[model samples]
Target: MRFLDPTKIAEVAAKFMELSSPCRLCPRKCMVDRISGQIGYCGAGSLPSHSGILQHFGEEPPLVGIGGAGTIFFTHCNMQCVYCQNFQISRGECGEFVTVEELANEMLKLQLFGASNIEPVSPAHQMHLFLEALSIAARKGLDLPVVYNSSGYDSLEALKLLRGIVHVYLPDLKYADSRMSAKYSDCEDYVEVARPAIREMYDQVGDLELDSNGRAVRGLIIRHLMLPNDISGTVETMYWIRDNLSSTVAISLMAQYSPIYEAWKFPELNRRVRASEYNKVVDLCWDIGLENVFVQELESQDLCIPDFRNEKPFSWD
Candidate 1:
């Protein structure tokens, strides 16, 4: 298996700390002076802000085997999803700032705990910092897959830099329509940015590849959390995937959307997804020639979104 270059990854990490003025690392292009510790829309400075770090089983089956994905919940996010389950941390409501050296320590700590992979949640705004920590871990004999868990609103240029660095790209194509994306996440150009960014991710890692033991060694895993009553324009999203991306890409059609964060404020997402809504989208994925699919049990909703706390980041401890 091909391993990421430890030296190159370390350079990318150190390069982020050298920024003087506003950093435009993410697609938001927020010109915030992160180097001098000025906060931006992401509520983060040059260094990374982590809420928790530990093994998590709330991920997909391949990611959450006996050895769970080593998940480090990065605080703050580029996009503000209306129904975010982890809004507390994503909105900077909770977390402690950690320098690049401290961040490196956290990565190594997870490795010592027998984690299958180092998973960074909501890392779009802190890609540079993540690369630095990854480099340190790589040099320290951390030889597990590095999973880049994101919300899919990434810059194509930034994604290009992550080529060969990220083993599995697990991103949520949240919206197919720009209006819905704007209304929910305040990003009208979500589809525009996400489409090309995902393409680049697929270009780097074509299809989801599993080992003989079924652990994901490499590739892209597209997650489309079927929103309440299929109101997120999932049908169009599936069609776009079939036409744009290769049919071999594995898709996790999730139905564990529980009302959390400020979901009750929006009538469309006030409740859980009905059975018919889940089936409709699942059927569409199959009809459109999407062969590789992973469906979450409807009962998995209660087990998916755990109470956001500072102690643990995932549903499964």
Candidate 2:
């Protein structure tokens, strides 16, 4: 496992904090002065707020070996996806604010719990705080690979800072069309923003590299959740990946889209993904010569939708 030097971590953390005041941590560039308690588009403040930290088995198989991925569910998100499963935290309805030292201890605790990697879910907005905590934890012997789990609406500047710190990049490429992105996530520039950010991630850590036990230590895994009625633009997105990125780039084509949160309000998104829809996307992956693809069973919808209100957000059984 590679860890950033404490000095470099501090430098990156400082730069991120500077970005936070003007609040350009994400593409939104809300400029709300989060340091002064002003809420931005993401609803995140200066301090890092998180809902839970646990050993999560629902992640990709490589991320979850004998010891599960150490997932820290960060509160608030740059995008307000109508069908967000973990809306309790994403909507800023639930979370606990922690200082840099306390957050460092949490990372150390996860390491002690025998986690395969430290996964920070929806971390773009609170990355500075995470880095500060990581610096402290690294010094205290937190030697696990760091997974930069994101919603894919990341800013280039923020992703650039994470070059050395993040070992595995787990990002969701939600939509290929701007119209769908605008209607669903209120981000018309999501495709434009996510593409370059993902490219940068791949440049930083090329392809997925696993250890002797087949546990992912470094690489990029692009997750595309199959939505009902092709709202996610699966075909275009897959082609884009094949043409722009690589056919061999790992893709997790998810079938676990349950109509929760405000998804019921939209007629197009008011149901789970159909078997045909899932099959079409899966078949398309093969058709496009996407060699490294992970497909989920349609029944995973019932098992993967997490309720962050509970102690254990995910239930494997």
Candidate 3:
């Protein structure tokens, strides 16, 4: 990785640190001076705020073979989806701040624990922290690949810095319709923002590449969570991926949307995606000629969500 170059790492860290001061890390662009102790719309500050770090087996198959993906659940997010499974952390209601050095330590810890790759969950809002920690981690012999898992609402300027640093780009294409995004995630520009952002991510890392054992060594994984009543615009999203990126780009079609957090308030989002809804999207993906698509069963809502009230936040069986 270019980020491992001794000189490049320092320059990359310095480049992103400037963004945190004014906090232009995400598309929200609240422009609060996180360096001067102001909080931005993303809920992260100059320091890194993380909820938990562990080996996550719930990721896509390539990211989770025998060794799980090393997942560092970051504290806040740029978007506020009412049906978010991990709303407690995404809304900035949980987690604690860690120094950049400690962040490096955590990465190394996950590596020692036999994680296949390091995944920074909801990292769009805290790119500076991730880069800084990665610089230190690289110096300390952290050799695992990096996975940039995000909500898909990223700033192009921010994504430019991630070219050689990120090996696996896993982003959620939540909605193709801006109005639906506005209603659910409060991101009216989600389609406008995500389309280009995903294109950039794919440009950085092409279609998913796997090792001899089928573990992801590099490339992009597009995750589209199917919402009830066709609100997620899965058909439109699949078409966009096929046209904009490539048909071979890996897609994780999720049927695990559970009505959690504040989703009970929204009548349209108050239940799991129906079997018909999930199958329809999968069929359309095939029709779109997408080749590398992974699917979850229609009844995947039974998976347990780790309660942040305790030490563990989520688990997969």
Candidate 4:
């Protein structure tokens, strides 16, 4: 489907920016009037800001073909997880502020660099900014599939605005329990928010589709980062995806959780995930009839870790 049709660009851009003022961009609904320069719970301004962009190979196989997935990491996450891998970026420690014009240039830069697809990481809060950039990028001949990579806490209103714009959706079903969500990310109704948001994403992009090179062209890919001691509630999250959505949905079961940021302060999250924990969750995926699964090896912990402090958060190594 053709996204960012020139005729509809203005309408889409206006609606999404309005949400920033009331800031119902995510489940937080901080209502901080970002349009008038109020930084809400997400810690982002009216304009978009970014940490880094790279032709990343760290994503799922389909997203990381020979061309490499064009990954754009956005700063200041809506949810501040205690064990965030990219702690500095998530906490809004470092980034280069950019205008809508600059953001559009970055999207084109990724496509010009031979990226398979344009994946906007952590874009839930900046839908308006992304749409504005995508509209300009499309005019400049950026015809790659757009991947909406996010923390599953998106809003239905904002997602509805993205119906035709986004070709692929890669979202994390982080927590199944509100208590755990509140404890880890400080959002009590995370499950309430993420479930419907993920459902909306599935409705938009039904299933994973790949190009001739096995690179993702369009679809929804669910990412679940298993936390230590079952805190991530893998079983519950998996069951929801199967029972509520479908058993055939692509799942990227991540085992790369590292205790950075404030994780060391909490006993349960201070250490790495045990092999048994990862194995148990991997086994559960099969037991529950989750077919298209991408299971990472335990040793990939080191490989998957990223430090946003450096100029390139990810590397060729």
Candidate 5:
């Protein structure tokens, strides 16, 4: 469990803060001065805007241990995925802005409430704010492992700033083809950006490492959501992971793709992932000899989809 050195907090915070103004945090590079209240492609400013922070059990098994992952759902996203489950937050329609100190307090609260780890969802755009808050939290006895949960469109420059700061890297390798990504997520270069970003993450943390209690303390966990009509390119993604990265790299194969939000606009994406589709991806993983993989049930859509309007967004069985 390598934690950020408390002394290097200010130096790190400064490096990320510099990137925020020009807004080069993510690969989008919408160079609007966020520090001066200018909004960019992600629709984020200097302050961190978030929907909620709670013990979310709807994650991977290691992430959702007995205590559950302390997930801080940040508002806005670099890419506007058509079938986003948390459309309310990702579209920047709803959320409350919080200062660095307040965010730090929330991290401490999650730790006090017995969370396995501090997981920040969609954190690429708000890396500056998170690092500042995390530094404050670390100074105030917050010792939990930090999970850099992202959409995998992160810039290498921003990821370099998080080398020592982040313990667990949970990123989504959403697409293997650019055409699918451009049509669905509005990111033409998602595969190009995500590949190296994931590689950097794996280089930083290596394979997934679990603690004595089976909770993830450090490592990289790549999430691949199987989409309808093979839009997600599961076979290409699986082979790429095996050939490029190690076969031992952890993978969370999601079968919970529901046609929510703007997915209705696209006929091809307006349905759930079929059992056959899910099975094929799972079988492909085995065929490729990818060792560390976590699979979800095909009927997990209802449990996986979250409603941010409610106080408790997810339903636990």
Candidate 6:
């Protein structure tokens, strides 16, 4: 389950930096000239901006045990989900832009704080910068696992660039139906884009594989959040994962949907997911014979929504 060798990682980083003009990194394909600092749909220029980095304990059990997952919260996102939990960061409410060198240093700092791995959340837009930072960290001897945490709306080409580089591919399969995707995340081609992207991820790295110590070494972890009702399109998506991908892949069925962002405007997503909805999705997971499934406590809905201003990201000392 080892990822790409360090040399291969640097090579990928070098190629990624060459992309300096209008970028089409994500499915949105805004094609804005990010190299020259013009903002695109993601609201990020060529550089990487961070809301914060901390050890997050509020993740799935495998990611966060007695310690925590080293989580870097990136500002802005490719998909502007109506029920986004991290609205403060995703909506660009605040962040600090740092150089690639600074980003490398941040990785080391997280390790110093006893973080399990460097988890880059919402990193789809900053792949180039992240690659640069990764190369730097690799040189400086940052040895922890690197988690590519993202929304599934990524380009297959861009994702291929990450082959062998990313250890754990943590991506959300948000919508099973295209219409629901367009209504909530403003991406009509979400299912189309995410499906192939996930297949590529699976091709690169199969199901979850762990080290001798039980920490993940390399693999794909699919996360699906059940929306307030049946609005999340979970049933079809679950079946898709079961049928298309191997049943061995670790699937995290999340019930931590606390309405944020512009969710109030949409009646179906205005409130927390109902118990019936969560149970239904769980039942579907079992029906599909998905054994490597992770489920959150329904009460976790209240805690998963971070108090972005004060709480910082999850970490353990």
Candidate 2, 1-317: lDDT as tens digits: 36557777778888998988888989999888888889988888878899998889889999996689999999999998999988899998988999989999998998898889889999999997898898888888788888999999999988988888789999999998888999999998998999999999999998899999888999999999988889999899999999999998999999988888999899989988889978987888898799999998777777887777777778662
Candidate 1 stretches with Cα past 4 Å from truth are: 14-21, 313-317
Tell me each candidate's TM-score.
0.94, 0.97, 0.96, 0.96, 0.97, 0.94
lDDT of 1 by residue, 160-224 (tens): 77776788999989988888889888887998999898999999988988887777879999988
lDDT of each: 0.82, 0.89, 0.85, 0.86, 0.89, 0.82
Reference-based lDDT, residue 104, model 2: 91
Clashes (N, CA, C under 3 Å) per candidate: 0, 0, 1, 0, 0, 4
Q: In terms of lDDT, which candidate is strongest?
A: 5
Would you list the clashing residue pairs of candidate 2? none
Writing each residue's lDDT as its tens digit, candidate 4 over 1-317 gives 45447546657878888877778888788989887778988888877888888898878889987778888888898997888888788888988788988888988898888988888999988778888888888888878888899999888888988887788899999988999999999888899989999999999989999878898877899999988888999888899899999999999999988887899999999888889988988888899899889999889887777877787777643
lDDT for residue 89 in candidate 2, whole number 0-100: 93
Better of 2 and 4 by lDDT: 2
- Estimate the overall C-alpha local distance difference test score of candidate 1: 0.82
Clash pairs, model 5 backbone = none
Candidate 2: regions farther than 4 A off: none
RMSD of each: 1.7, 1.2, 1.5, 1.4, 1.2, 2.0
lDDT of 2: 0.89
RMSD of 3: 1.5
* Model 1, C-alpha of 175: deviation from truth (Å): 0.3
Ranked by lDDT, the better of candidates 1 and 4 is 4
N/CA/C clash count, model 1: 0
